[model samples]
Target: MPSNPTLLDDQPATGAPPSSPSATTIGDLEAGLDRLQSQGPPARRDLVRSLLPVAAVVALLCVWQILSWAGLKRSDLLPGPLTVAASLADAFADGTLQRAVATSLLRGVSGFAIAILIATPLALLLAQVRTLRAALGPLVSGLQVLPSVAWVPAAIIWFGLTDATVYFVVLMGATPSIVNGLLSGIDQIPPQYRSVGTVLGATRLQHTLLITLPAALPAYLGGLKQGWAFSWRSLMAAEIIAVGGSIGFGLGSMLQQGRDLSSMPLVMAAILAILVVGIVIELLVFSPLERRLLRRRGLLTQGAS
Candidate 1:
């Protein structure tokens, strides 16, 4: 047997290169398992994600406090968060902040409502008729890009420092945004949706309202959110210029007065008040709506807030 060299070549040692299924070696299985384990979501990661902003804010406050302790020349200019918080409290206690907030909200919400009423019909007209879209699409886009603040001066000239001026500026800023949002949404609808109603024997108007508008809801919501932002900004800018007119002085006026009086904390508080309003709105209204919509559409995946 030892002498037969031919036997060695014919009998081959390592077994018929393993069956196809055996191609998955232990190392391959281990690597695949490692990949899956790495991808697994952690419970704590969600909690940490929610707290990160709070942590960052705390860090920023610490830095500001340290800077103040170092006796910087601009300490007055860069007041600590606590100082601004105190000023804000005082404003609230005296009804100043409350009055300004109420006045501003009234103007902003009114303008926004009017914008929606106007912008929706306009957007619908453009969306339904190719001719109108071609004629005014660029104009609408241009108006959206133009700063809302720029409208403040024009509004004053037109309305002469009344509540109407504030409303005008807010409308100018918000209307274009709402129209654009709705138009964009309408554009996104599939061609099939238009005919879906026609197949069901709907009249042209009925078809549009039932099929097309329903399909454009996401885009409409986007436009609505954008309109609110525009309205708020425009209202603030108008308030700054139109104070002591027909309306009570607003947050913008408070800021201007703080500046005139050289009250750094007051100025900071006013600025913070503006920011807080935006944050509160997003948290209470916009964020929840967006998240709910996205979650429903399977576009967003996150742990419970």
Candidate 2:
């Protein structure tokens, strides 16, 4: 009897019995995904979108160059962008920059992977058990607030100046944020989602796998992004503080070496390298994944910042 065609479209067709709620929800999600996929913007717009950030970075570097030239006497203390670039080039030519980047990235990736494996199951367990959540949720959140650098000394003492220490710091830094993100996602799920799954005869595992996870993905992915940031930061701290000849030289070690030699250009170069690596990971890995997810959920429009 509804006058709206859209309303009628959702209703049973020609006296057919109503579709189950779970079926209706699934169909809606699939239709939304397809619609969003077809609505993506033109390639030209995507090109422009990508160029904006590059332009901003160029402008910032120009300003840095101007400032460095303005203060000739302080140039030794505060090297210009060009000086930093030249230093970076020298490091690259000697393969020090490349080796440091490779070592740091390997540790970061491995630590983050281990954190994910540990956090996911622990998060699920905490979500299911009210008593455990009540007892441990605050502790997990508290851990996230603690600076990752603080864990460096403890890790060094417990595991020595080896790779084990770096990984321990990374795991400690990343896992809490991931756990909190999943728990928060689970909390946000509507009661009807659980009821619908139960009514459709879904087993406990089926309900979690099919319904819970997909619904919780956005927040979970956010947590994963934050977790990676923490892991990288923690790895850097451990490398700087727990340096040993046995451990491979990483970006942190390069920065520390610069400080020891009073080489401002090398210090600036190392810092720039760290920033570049983080930006590359963000753009090449997380950004695309996040955009795809947001677009699929109709929360983001193509070419929108």
Candidate 3:
């Protein structure tokens, strides 16, 4: 509970529009959100901690090699790590890997950007409008859990082997995530913050943008990360299902080609390329952003590993 709490009842009688929320009240709301936060950042990770992921990858490779030697499947069907590595090297030297990665990344980023543009205002409108929220809230929430690949048939039917088809799938997968995240942030805000904003005579827009929105930052960040994941997954699915010579080949296309050729090494390399791209973005982009946000808000106490 807040000390010297401000509630609707505590506000002085007013006639004009509410003013902006006080900085103190905003600060208090931030603190309250922290209290309600169910998760916290893990302990500080350093050089050794970073190496853990590399070590895990090495261990998995060893296991894969052992499985190959144990003859779980014919060598032709299940290539060893060295074979896959060689295939990856060949793709890299020929520039196929680079082009495939670039194409896939472009699609994923474009879709995610479009999703943010659509979702931001949609979420804000829904958050503020009681009737709209009541009607569509559950539907929107459900959309986040719906598999991105399920949209492929409809997208293909409508847009037909074009970039538009791929974009539609990405939009379907990512928008729910971004909207839900923003709404969740808005919901997590303490009512007292609104009361204080009212007492200060802030307009609805001002209160929402300045108070509710800023207070919702942590939740918004999580949603943004999920949106990226959804977009990436959707893009790969679209690329696989909507393969066209007109549309430049992507990483997923590489995988399909490998399958068609019955080359396990190429297939494994393509799979790893997809996984590595996602991991790289998460590690280099989202993780750093998250850590910075937590640290800036005085919510994280990271010690050197």
Backbone Cα, N, C clashes tallied per candidate: 0, 0, 5
Q: TM-score each candidate.
A: 0.80, 0.84, 0.82
Model 3, runs deviating above 4 Å:
1-45, 301-305
lDDT of 2 by residue, 115-170 (tens): 99999999999999999999999999999999988988887777777888888999
RMSD of 3: 11.3
lDDT of 3 by residue, 207-297 (tens): 9888988888889989999999999999888888888836788998999899889898999999999999999999899888888888777
For model 3, the local distance difference test gives 0.89
TM-score of 2: 0.84
Candidate 2 local lDDT, residue 226: 97
Tens-digit lDDT track of model 1 for 1-305: 33435445655676454333234555676898899878454333376787898999899889988887777858678787788888999999999999888777777788899999999999999987899899999999999999989988787788887888888899999999999999998889888877777778999788778887878878898989999998988888888777776767888889888888999999988888887887788788887897777656655655654
Candidate 2, residue 227: how far the Cα is off, in Å: 0.4
What's the TM for model 1? 0.80
> What would the TM-score be for candidate 3 when compared with the true structure?
0.82
Give the best candidate by TM-score: 2
* Span of 10 residues, lowest total lDDT, candidate 2: 1-10
